[model samples]
Structure formats: structure tokens, C-alpha cells
Target: MEHDGQLELYTAVADQLKEAHARVRASQVPEGVRMALTRKLLVITAAAKHDLADAARRLESFMKDLDEGRIPEEDH
Candidate 1:
């Protein structure tokens, strides 16, 4: 896939995460548990963001390698 396609996919993922976070924040739960859950969600969201960045970097690198004729041999 091309860079634009990758970017559109990433943007959709980001939008979904934003919507999830908003829903969690808007929940009407007990105070202590709500705060704890919110914090945990924040950490999870951050980790997901990091993972997404890493995936994008890897995809770009792979594309570059392919463009440069660095394809590996297929196993029969």
C-alpha cells in the first residue's frame, strides 16, 4: 500500500481511540474506581500510540527496501 493509504488507516485508528477515551471519560461511575480506570486507560492509550508509531516506521522501511530492489527470496 502507498503512504497515503497507510496514513488514512492510521488516522482512522486514532479517531477510534479518541472516541473510546471520550466515552470512558464521560462514564458515571464511582469516583475512586472511575479515576483508576481512567488512569489505566490513559496508559493503554499511550502504549498503543507508541506501537502505532513503531508500526508506521517499520512499514515505511519495508516499502523503501522493496523500492530499492531488496526483496528476499521466497521459500518454496
Candidate 2:
């Protein structure tokens, strides 16, 4: 991905995570609302966590290459 595209994607993900977290935190909402929002939050949280983990793995691989005095390449 281009640098700008990557930044935009990350920003959107962050905004979604914040919104989902807030929805889950609103305890005054009705049970039905809470249930629906909790599901949404869980889905988004899982997705975001997955993305983060992948990024971490890539970074680790890149750092390992750097330590071995080699340039890292894109995973894809």
C-alpha cells in the first residue's frame, strides 16, 4: 500500500475501534441495544487485533532481517 493509503486505513480503523468501544461502554442503553453493540464491538475488536498482530509479525520479520544486515521485503 502507498503511505497515504496505509495512514488512511489505520485512521479509519482507529475511529471504528473508538466508536465500537464507546457503544459497548454505554451501560444505560437497553439490553437489546447493548447486545447488538457488544457484538459489533467484538467483531471490530477482533479484526483490529488481527491486523495489529499481522503488522507486529511483519515488523518482527523486518527487524530480524535488519539484524542480519539484509533489507526486508514486502510480505506479499
Give stretches of model 1 more than 4 Å off.
53-76
Lowest-lDDT window of 10 residues in candidate 1?
67-76
- The Cα RMSD in angstroms, rounded to one decimal, for candidate 2 relative to the true structure is 17.1
Position 18, candidate 2: lDDT: 66
lDDT of 1 by residue, 1-76 (tens): 6888768868865665565457546755556645654554555456556676654454444445434655443322
lDDT score, candidate 1, position 52: 69
What C-alpha lDDT does candidate 2 achieve relative to the native structure? 0.53
Per-model TM-score versus the true fold: 0.50, 0.42
Candidate 2's TM-score reads 0.42
> Which whole-number lDDT from 0 to 100 does residue 8 have in model 1?
87
- Predicted structure 1, TM vs. truth: 0.50
